[model samples]
Target: MPSTVPDSLDGWWCDSSTEYAFVGFSYEVTACQSRSTLNSEFKDIRETFDGRYVRLYGACDRTGFYDDVIDAAWNNGLGVHALIWFGFEGGSEWKDRRDNLIDTLWNNPKAKFVTRAVQFGSEPLYDYVLDPSDLAGNIWEFKWNIEDLGIPVTISELAYGYQVRGGAQIVLDSIDVLDAHILPYFSQTASTGDAAWKDVNNDLNWFIDHAAGRKIWFSQNGWPSTHYSGVEPNSPDAVADVDNEERYYKLLESKCEFFKSVAGGGVGWFWHIYADWQEPGYGLYAESGKTKFDFKPRTEC
Candidate 1:
């Protein structure tokens, strides 16, 4: 069958998430009140590169980062397709901040903020991670927040892992947008040349079959160019002898096909692209300023 990749992937993720997180949490993830990295990395890439969309979560305080990234993307022939913000603990604080942030972003003509916003970053797991009740509470709060925004809201990270049983039920009322968070293969399997790319493909199929009446996006999906714990490698280099370049291309091809056949058929979709991680080669560009393996994919045909 031919690939059914969405007519437009306009993928989105974060430079903040990648540069600052350490075993999943980075300084940038937590340090929302610091000086801006916006004018440099975020703005430069959004304007200079072919990057069409950029995702930002929380940081209502820095307002500058929000303005810079969106402004750069809008001014540079690109669009800030989504303005992703986070909700926490069913707290009124989160809702209050959500309103202020949305107002600030939308009010500024230079900011170019639209109703195209996402509610949670990784908040769905708030029950296990925070309060057991928070999982549902947060979702409800999100629905309210989205209704307030008068725009569609996406739950950016929906886990297939055990913590998210009844995953579809948990998010049904809270989100208009759903993304499958699938990360296949990592160090151990890839190092031994034993990893298969099938895991990611299977996860995509499982998500597609399960997510009905919901708009879907492979919100957090990709293979590490290298490897890490819990997340394995489906990289071409993992196989030593098979041409690495071809392997890389196949990986991208497969991902694009999955998005076409499965995700695009749903509601909306996005791919994760982190620009500044020097560790296991997870981005299209390395921190040292080189294209990781040269098989990078673009949004436009």
Candidate 2:
């Protein structure tokens, strides 16, 4: 539990933890990439990163999207935790959208077979459109509705939403596991990647102390590589930069055992993204195929 990070930036952390980390990433289900490219992407994840699953963020309503991505995962021997993204602050439309996806899944055999879980929403409570209790009620509703298909239901929010936000505990029975998002950069409490890892560990420990009966999964978690102009994160006291992102990757490898320990508030995390896109650019691989850091996760960790 002491600092695994090197004392100076001149050295990198060595990962000796023997525990196999059940890693994952959020991959874009885009038609822009050729079928071979898609296949290669999933192949790299399973072989290169030892990934067990992938998180699909959007396009759940489309039948084609499911057909495409699920097949890719299946071919690569990976399962998927598909998402129903209601990326909004307020809306009654999400209810209809949720039902539409259920309808989509109910009809599709591949989706039913390859899908491990269906996350109802991303940060609905954190966005404040729905209160914690109301959000929990929605998740409960979704859980039972998808029961016949045998897919577990959950919601993605900050861990604080489950712990501090009111009435979130009421929905525990309805969910298979808690898919909370953890971003210490956004928390603004830590100044460096080492501190951020400690912050994350402390947060997970808090979950162990408080939410003792629940299995927590950080379905969305990562540090940004850069802002708009290739500078540091837009904060005076923050460390959301390439250096910290690289540092975070090292720490992740070093603490693989701690992360995957099922009994110790362990979480299955999907690094928030595989590459940069529209905004808040948290890309491991950039637009021009440039890697922000040469993050070979398991190799020589």
Candidate 3:
């Protein structure tokens, strides 16, 4: 059977949980903030964005969280790339968690319909949570078991991780898709405006050259609308304020078009976030639930 996931890499990374205080890389996993809020966000995403796919960081467990997101996305005519959280302290339970998540989705008609792909984990190598060899083993096992579900499987990682690590190569070999996170903001010389577009394209090219012909999907990419310094001392500062955020979005949109023209398709790009949260200034929407940038790309292609 043909895959349900789109070939195009146009999507958004969405987080509905309000508990993302960013305390030690953790967040509360609620099914959703509220019914009305979830509904509105899904609707806006469907109507406003050109793409129909959204990537969620977690499968949201079996509670109201997973069901609500699936229901909202399906009702809004959107698809999801659901991720299974890996790399917890006692990571042995990941297999069980993965099984439960798949079973949950398989049983839920709405979730099964909206879910386009299953991403095994997000940035496992970057956090040093798992060794490359071990992660590859887990991915191989998960892919083998989940292939019967008829959904594509992949893992998310930094573009550089694949170049320098063993697990990334294993992941690339085992999965149907190549999901990478290319954030220009994390580069040594952080880029802004048009320069940002160039930086991202360079990153994209690097991945393309190294991906060994696998379909590439940018699982996360975006510029923060605040001036907050990143985790490391030399990290790039986020673009300050709403106006610059709009500029950053336009630049990225243009770059996406450029990529499609040159790369000949079979790639995907998702912005880092759908809305702002406790991370200070990374959201497209402010904490007040208002859009931070009223991005109106000139070439609406």
Question: How many Å off is the CA of 16 in candidate 2?
Answer: 22
Q: Which candidate leads in lDDT?
A: 2
Work out the TM-score per prediction.
0.63, 0.80, 0.79
lDDT order of candidates, top first:
2, 3, 1
lDDT of 3 by residue, 79-128 (tens): 77777776546555666668777676767755656776777777777765
Per-residue lDDT over 23-59 for candidate 1, one digit per residue giving the tens place of the 0 to 100 score: 1111122344333554345444544444444444334
lDDT for predicted candidate 1 compared with the true structure: 0.44
Per-residue lDDT tens digits for candidate 2, residues 46-72, read 887777678776544443556667667
Of 1 and 3, the candidate ranking higher by TM-score: 3
Can you tell me which runs of candidate 1 are displaced by over 4 Å? 1-49, 57-63, 81-100, 109-115, 130-133, 146-148, 161-163, 186-196, 227-249, 254-258, 263-271, 277-280, 295-301
Superior by lDDT: candidate 1 or candidate 2: 2
Weakest ten-residue segment in model 2 by summed lDDT: 9-18
For candidate 3, the TM-score is 0.79
**TM-score for candidate 1, residues paired by index:** 0.63
